[model samples]
Target: MLRPALLALFLTGATAPAFAQPPTETVPLLREIKQWVIGCDNLRNCHALSAPSGVDEEDYSSLTLHLWHQAGPQGYLRLRFDHRGEDVDLSTLLLDGKPLGLELTQDLHIELDDQGGDPEVQSFGGIEDAAARRWLQRLRNGQRLQLPGDEAAHVSLSGLSASLLLMDAVQGRLDNVTALSRPGKGAASEVAPRAPAPVLRKFTAAAPLTAEEQAGLVAAALQAVKPEEGEPEATVGALTAQQAMTVTRYDCAAYNCEFDVSSRERQAPYKETPMDLQPLPLEDAALQGSVGYDEASGTLSYFYKQRGIGDCGGGASWVFDGKRFQLSEFHRMPRCTGVGYGDWPALWTTVPAP
Candidate 1:
């Protein structure tokens, strides 16, 4: 199934410092334009990618086109091509089966990297405003984009125009000179300024839990979460009764499990509240993902994998500022186009509060 990226903000408590505020238009937006998907983050940075042709194909061999632009007068447009087979030769790139007779390296610098894990995968792309404009103009009306040698590795251009237009609108570049779809004589100064990323105050008071304390906490957490009535107790080897209980209650056999502090607050002396009062946010709150928590840093992370291969997903992390959990990082990749987790476009970022 094709997974559409869901957008939600988890606000921190009142104790968080007011170091910086997001843009007035802080709402994140995601839209599916035919075979393409576009998303704009809280800071107004927009990203669009070509969707894979088949959702059920397991090989994960597909050609993906990525376009990104930051929101501001000085922001430069960037483009990249990702392929799962091998490195792409830009000199042989084709638009509707016709060659683009232009010197690509003069305006853009392309770098090929192994992307670290799979030796068969490679990506290259970096083009500023002028090069980006020229490429966009050539591709705006095309039917298909063909890479060298690989007949199956081609991106559909059905919704390319509409996706670019939506990106321009989201970043307030419509009809302006910097617009990707609708360019005009309007000065670059007419574009909106980039919004400041929010700042988070870190808390360092958390102490690492001893082995005994950690085991006790895990038991207490499992007991607090009551198992559903009529549900048979799960059986697993090499696990204690408490561990089995945790597995059954959380369905950890199928999905991965980790600790989260948000579900249960710890008062002084390490007292835990009942599960009914504070259910796991991964299952109860609007956020949807498998959660993991680090006791040493007081950081809770949530990641939802769109598929088992883990090529696409949305994830966020928050830090506990001695009182509440403040969002520290957020990113999403709506399309399963072979983009790596580190390359996902960030929708929200934060720095340490002064």
Candidate 2:
């Protein structure tokens, strides 16, 4: 779920409807354009356009979108739009692999089909007609669109009028979006926050966690819990040697899938250097429950909480999808183990960027 505090961000802004601006006289002379060549799925005139069969517009999540049109007989126009609460100011637009110079006095947020395909290019009388045709035509193709990225492109005058007029000629408001409906609020909610990934080891030559340091870690973990609820408190088993420890193999279907989680007790710190004892405890921080993971999208997430001396507590985690096997998350607080918290000098990690 999205953080409740961020709800305010999704609320539409109170900006007044833009006033109609007269097209600059020079615009009538420009011919470049910017647009997102959408797949002709659910389009009223889908059968009219010459396209490969079977590559239906219905199945795709990505498309090539750009904005850079050049100056021509028509005046260059820049296009800008608000995207996910951010402004996309583009100087150029790329439509169907072609480029064009653009200039936008006001923001123009519109959606362009990112579905992979041979971008159709024909001709355009100028930039003004191109923009109008580019955006207005979406409705006829059975889709209402908002400005997407700032990418721009050059428009073929012949295709510009045909496509734009086709869009303007027909109108149908999409209510139930299955395969061809325009994206809506429900679409936004489907977005998921990415889980943490396995990260590079950061501890090189660091002092082991002392009794006090272990306690500090427990404190930090508890504090990180949001809303002050579901606090994963430290437990004695977490600091005991006989705490529950399981090592199961996982078949992750997606990236960032955690493959394994390992935990064991240690008596003394390892004699080897910190780097040599990676994904293990080498310090004097007695801890139980060390999280472990195999594959990571990026940063590895590791945790250790100790309740007392000669005891350590921690766990490792990785991203795992149910493609092959799945690793479950710890739903309960960890117990203490007899393992000395020392030798805890190392943890699962990956290199980090600046």
Residue-level lDDT of model 1, residues 1-354, one tens digit each, is 111111211122112112121233334776678778776766677878887545766423467778877676666677877667755666677788887655653454445453354555556666766888788887889888876677768878889999888877776677778788888776777776666667777656444444554555555555555543433221111111121112223534334332333233222223433322112222224134476555556565677777766667787877666555677767676777776676676666556676
Off by over 4 Å in 1: 1-26, 56-61, 105-119, 226-249, 253-270, 273-289
lDDT of 2 by residue, 84-147 (tens): 2232333344434333235332224443423331233111121343463344334233321222
Residue-pair clashes per candidate: 0, 116
Candidate 1, after superposition: displacement of residue 6 in Å?
25
Worst 10 residues of 1 by lDDT: 1-10
Q: Whole-model lDDT for model 1 versus the true structure?
A: 0.59
Best TM-score goes to which candidate?
A: 1
Runs in model 2 lying further than 4 Å from the true structure: 1-89, 96-105, 108-260, 266-354
TM-score of each: 0.76, 0.21
lDDT of each: 0.59, 0.25
After superposition on all CA atoms, how large is the RMSD of candidate 1?
8.2
